[model samples]
Target: MTDQAPAPAINADRLWSRHMEMARIGPVEETGNCRLALTPEDVEARNLFARWCREAGMELTSDRAANMFARREGRDPARAAVAAGSHLDTQPHGGRFDGVSGVLTALEVIETLKDAGIETDAPLMVVNWTNEEGVRFGPGILGSAWFAGRIDDATLDDIRATDGARFAEEAAASGWRGTATPADLPMEAFFELHIEQGPMLEQAGADIGVVDAVQGLCWLDVAVTGMDAHAGTTPLPARRDALLAAAAMLVGINDMGRASGEDARVSVGRLKTATEGPSTVVGASEFVIDIRHPDQAMIAHLQEECRRVCAEVARRYGCGVEVSQRFAIPPTAFDGGCVAAVEAAAQALQLPYRRMASGALHDAANVAAHAPTSMIFVPCRDGISHNVAEYASREHLAAGANVLLRAMLAKAG
Candidate 1:
């Protein structure tokens, strides 16, 4: 068989410009962005994306969960489509590239295919999954969750934002909630291009990453309640301090994960205590613990230990404790075939790639459950994410997008 033509010459300058312009929407000068899911800024970004898709002659559609799909029909309209893209929602202070690059790259891929006058056997689609950040809604991958039937309408309707705003109300106000169902569309394969969100590629001196699996994640919100007393008047042994118990639990959780080995990580990112008065002992304290591991059994073990530790700490402090699961997603491995395709594409392009597991949870983790899914990762500057300083080089971006383009073309063809 004759070899396929070389990958099209991607317009790096144009791509970077597009990314910069979009980044400015919810921009926070030194920090990254704050376009929380379903917020007004998020709505503005979606509108701009739809407009961009229309300019490229791609038909756009929104599902009931507010997931957006931009489509470019192929030779056979009846077959399942080859799809690519990522989420648009940002964390509280997320960087620009985390989710936006995947989306813009997918759009660029379609533009490249059209400009090259190439036709595939199946339709191509770019997706923008809503609430992937989960900063506002509490659950990440909200769109994909609803699409996969993992989340229902009633549950989604009841989800409230950090501002106590109802999800459905905001979606309707933005005019994004549509009649289409996520599962109604036929998808043959799904691919996502993203930043490594870690230092893997940069540290290894590699240009790209072909993700093999995503680590399992369990997010728990723990609350410790104790009797409030005067800090100066109450003896240390007599006080039932909630904050102290919480601090002990945090340290215990970290120690547990550290002892478990390299794949385990525990983070207590948010902490709140009742009664902001400095002199008053804390009556109640709540914190969010995010635990992740690639091994399912290990994650379970860690979680159990955490629960036991919390109970013990509460007992020691004479406080009541409660743990709630905010989010739980099992470890997910990418399709072997899709992984092979990405590897082959990298080899063809003479690029260096390493097989790595994603430490950060992504929408792809959810999609992989129901579809043959894989992801390509570019390197970030300092393995930083969910911040304004998150950055990736232009060369890395182009390389990742090219891999995405080739992989999608191969699958569609």
Candidate 2:
């Protein structure tokens, strides 16, 4: 590796302008975007991205799942491409930089190389994995999951969006879907440049983040049952309120998470009761516990602890409780060589950075199963994401793109 930085560095102004241009297609409140997968807004955004790729002299291809790939030819045509990018689809209330940064910054890298007339030993690619937000569809990261062989073709095709649109039908309508398979476009390495989506780098005053792992996640569905009775007539000592038991379970689960350490995350974002009337005692309550940890073993332990706490809390309230796992994703450790490339890029660029684990799941997690993959994170303002106020400054984004460019070059060479 050379101590000197590459010539024709990423253009901060151009990158920021591209972000603003894409944000216009699905504009929301102020700076937010809402380009749900396969929707009209998303199609427009894809068309725009395709146009930009064509303008840059990159050949664009896509898969049956509607995942987009733009390739820049290299000296060795047979070598697998070094790929980079993230999703283009946004959450219903996502900000401009969440997934957009990954895609645009990748394009910026390719553009910088093209302008400098530099070619590598392996081809370079920019990808836009579909349905990553999964706001309309049932599951997120649908595109990468299919590409990684985790989901079968029939199952992926049959999935219906919340608005009743079939996945296959929508994909066909988007006009970007094709027959390209993972085998057809092999990857030597993949890099995703994304906003931190959390406040860590910003709080630490860092310029870049070298992402090494993604946390595992588990969801437990819990139910508490009790006999309904009149709120006024039921004696406090004789009452078996399911709501009360569930409330106690929530507190216990939170405390368990807190005690587990800083890496542990447990949350009950949704809850429901059978009875709503103030005069009637609730007979049934249901809630989901979201548990997460960087270690798979710790996730299992936390899940079991949550179940035990719910059962004990139910017994204390004279209620019957049931806890079942909804789903779980094992923690993902990125490719070591790719991770080292990112770290080395930071060091070479003289950017203050930290090696960190991603708290939220990303398309990079799925791609890791199929290829040597890692990620670069630019700090967002206040660590906020999935909201209209999500933000990353031009300097930080350009910094991340430079790291991505360097890392991709290292791998491609």
* Top lDDT model: 2
Give every collision pair in model 1.
Answer: 31-388, 32-388
- Find the 10 residues in a row with the least total lDDT in model 1: 1-10
Write one digit per residue (lDDT tens) for candidate 1, span 246-348.
9998988888878888778889999999979999999999999888988889888888888988999899889999998887778998999888888898888
- Model 2 is weakest, by summed lDDT over 10 consecutive residues, at 1-10
lDDT of 2: 0.93
Q: Which residues of candidate 2, in runs, are more than 4 Å off?
A: 1-7
**Model 1 TM-score?**
0.85
The count of backbone overlaps in candidate 1 is: 2
lDDT of each: 0.87, 0.93
Candidate 2 lDDT tens digits, 318-383 = 999999998999999999999999999899889999999999999999999889999999999999
Which pairs clash inside model 2? 198-383, 199-383
Residue 245 displacement (Å), model 2? 0.9
